[model samples]
Target: MGAATPSAQGPRILGSRGSGSSPATGPEAPGSPLTASPGGRMGLPGAEILVGLVAGIDVNMPCLGFALVAKDLEAARDVLRVCERLGIELSEPFYTRKGLCVTAVVELPWYENPVHFLRRRVEGYLRYMLPDVRRVRRVWGRLVWKRVRLPAAEADVLMPLVERLLREYGMPGLKLPATVAEDLEELVYEWGRRWRRSYDWAFKVATGRIFRAVSRLSRRHVVLVKLEDLRGIKRKEKWVPVIRRWPWTRLLRLTLGCTPPWVGVALVNPRGTSSDCPACGGELKEHSYRELVCESCGRKWHRDAAGAANVAFAKPVEYLRFPASSPMNPKKPGGGEDGGNEETQRTSRLVDKDPQPRAPRDGSRPVAGVEHTRQRGPIEGLTLTRPQTLPPGFPASKG
Candidate 1:
């Protein structure tokens, strides 16, 4: 590996040593299409792409961090460092295994549930159709259910009102029933089911946009994602339902479903991708909001990008079950219930042979410059009014 040479600015660019050549011409260089795409006519065969999934800063906000890097571990670190210093996007097109100039054209805010609208209409319809029924109590912003029950005669009279409500709030292209059912409760439940199904469809469409952009980038390489089960994650010594805070599993399923048959999907252990330094396998300490510094190498990295790069090369500790022989199934042939894929497993074995640097050869500590010395910790009580966008080069997400 080469040593980092800093320009007049703070970020270091990988020169001709650690990477075997300058990144501009190197085979694993992310900037070069010849090497970056990997496995096409000009790319090296059997290369894998990395993606780091970071949850959003706020619980109410529907966003996740998707930083990426696809190159030599050292080179990826350098590129990520450069991106931070230059104020460029955190994820490069190369990390996505997509060619340069690929663009995402999908519309955003994939899921828009009409359950709330239906709830509101039901309240009004009850007042107009059955004056005897009064909302005697409100629980957590919803009208008490027993008060809204209707007699069979009232249900029949409300059929026309229910039909009009469905027409008003129903999504376009959805098939409407020939006539409203005699049971108002059944009709309400049916509308809820229809909306839920439509939500799943919209989620697929949003993910499809991301896949189309990735496919346009490159047609050859498989996308390897580092997924961690964060449903039971702990925060500040308190148990929190992280999945309810954000749809972590939903995003994973959407990614698997949208991927084309030609491209492969592999799930790797997310364990230390964000905490370990990709360059030296050293532990990383938080340096700032969403940034990290390697304790051993003393280099700064954007948390998301460094994690994504490490994911590309991280080994899977356990078998991740998915559909067999599908593009989303990363399991090797004949591995059956326990087999692992070749790309990440092979790379981890190769990396083990190299001597991991425990300390910088230069006999200097990581520069405690103004940038590195800042306070490092999580933001508390942060909230956003609107969904945040993914780092440039991918789809605009509002999941």
Candidate 2:
């Protein structure tokens, strides 16, 4: 779902949570009065429970990095409670992995240009992030292909069905309280304030703005926890020792909840795998860049076609041809002029001893009785023939 309005660049607001300054502003403020309470015990119900799909979108350009863990009604509500405590913005329901899915979109703002921002952010999250754009595109393409494979178009029309389901589930027109903006501002300030000792004011402000904007615009409930904050808590508290303790275990039981069994994890980019030839279990090195040549058999195909074929589950047809001979070497024991001479001797041994008539080399019709020329004529008979001629009008003078 979309946010109420586009984020505006303004001075840092210290402790604001919603749109309006009033505490009685957003969706959760009414049910839980402490939602607007300054420092009282604030309690909210847990989120809805359903199968979850955790999708991480790492944008390279503009360096926007977002992670979404989407669950059904129960889990979503619990997540919302957590987000509310932190003063993050919550949006209305939207379609996602399944029909009528409620999502929380977390926006990440990068101060630098898109390219530089993405590179740096991605390097930080490399373990969780996919490498190439093609991998991300492929994941989406697979989803589309699944729909195309469906027998009926209606069976695969996910978006429309989700919209209908959401309407039926009483999820339309859900709005955020005005005070959420203020709380969001406070949370962002705290996040940035912690880093103020090490970072400049500009960095803190810019980062704070990004955190708030992301919390608000997220499709589902978004929790904007700084990476540094998490790391700091882990270092000081030592999570392993605390997890084993009694009261902390019960108090933070929600965090220990196991994910649903049906949740699927899809790897965006598998390492050392060729995107083109997924079927034949062949690699790009099997062929040149432009042509796909098989090393096993002398089969050749266009590189693109080979890639497509690799994806398709098909048996390869073999064509027989002469095998290429290896180059002969004179120095090698079995290769060289000596080997050729041996082969010629062997061939001669295979022939009969009887003399046979040989053909003329000049290509003239052979005279049946005459022998072919074998030697040159003597030098004494090599004189040139003189031309015979008559005087001008000699016949008339004789008459």
Candidate 3:
């Protein structure tokens, strides 16, 4: 742990929510055209590009918008036809100056307490020694090695110099043990990136969100599919004020403008992608560890995969009917004649819950207070839309 993300000093564009909120809804009609979707304003008719809106979060892997390849407008849906490897999974959750920033946890460290302490001590010193907010702000904002964060950068610059200066002072015990030195360095750099991104997510009224979405979409030439916010699904998930304020769809368009002129953005109404079963129209049973057990057919599904599938392949029927006989929705608790409910929970990505620290991705508790890193990598999920032209102003012209 290099430095914990401090909401006050870091960024906080949006807020966070509780669990089991909106649980999940099923997918819409398979291959149906999506017009005026919530995620983004771009209209995806389902034939032009291989668009797979992200629906849920995997305990092990976080996903963002997934991609598939397609040249013309009438491409076929190949579930496996994705970009090199990208999707719309959020980063680790942290409060930003403006709102919530969702990032992924690439690595975890055990010394969270120490890292936080270091961050506070150093930041305090910076604030005091360098009284000017502008200068202190500059140091904190500068990317570490143009890659990592503050503590990581500071550690790299200071550790050796401090050790050298103190070599004759008999303070050898202050040096970080060689065993944890390597891991600590990596952790700091990573935290720097993660912590700063929280601010980036909310900075400039969501300029960072737009930049990230567009950059990723442009690089892959993939269509940016916007899904509804998952907040509206259930009351259990406390409504996040910042989430309501953030214009994710607008960010998608801004990202589109930044993309190569050819890459496109699209939207999909991701209603009921989480609750209804795709294998059969059966009500899905919520499972621990983020899975859905189909009550009608007794099939088990990973929550993220199922939700992504629904995002991509839900039915054409505008209205969804809950099984009247099911115990969870007995008498169709949220169902009606045309759809389940008029005020149905039409929320967005199950990319997942609160801003709090998450358990290890593998679902195992830390044994002896030690957590092992997973060996897996991010998934190359469904989509296809490659950029034909590089955006303008690449490799800034040297005078």
Which window of ten consecutive residues has the lowest lDDT sum in model 3?
Answer: 319-328
**Which residue runs of candidate 3 sit more than 4 Å off their true CA positions?**
1-62, 65-226, 229-237, 240-260, 314-399
User: Candidate 1 — what's its lDDT?
Assistant: 0.41
Per-residue lDDT over 168-260 for candidate 2, one digit per residue giving the tens place of the 0 to 100 score = 433322211224223333443443333333223333333343344333323223221111001133245444422221121221121112211
* lDDT leader: 1
lDDT of each: 0.41, 0.31, 0.37
Looking at model 3, residue 89 earns an lDDT score of 37
lDDT of 1 by residue, 63-100 (tens): 23343333344434443444455433443243233322
Candidate 3 lDDT over residue span 1-399, tens digit each: 233333212111122222112322222244434332332222234423343222111111122222222233222122122221333333222232212223221212122333353465444443342234233444543423222123453454444443443353333333433333344456556666774454334333323333444344333233333333333433345643233323344434444454444333233456677787655668888887666799987877656555644453432222111111211121345432223544322321122243224467658665654545554665466344556775787554343
Q: Candidate 3 versus the native: TM-score? A: 0.29
Candidate achieving higher lDDT, 1 or 2: 1
Ranking by lDDT: 1, 3, 2
- For each of the candidates, give the backbone clash count: 6, 39, 62
Q: In candidate 1, how many Å is residue 189 off?
A: 1.6
Q: For model 3, what is the error of residue 105's alpha carbon versus the real structure, in angstroms, after optimal superposition? A: 13
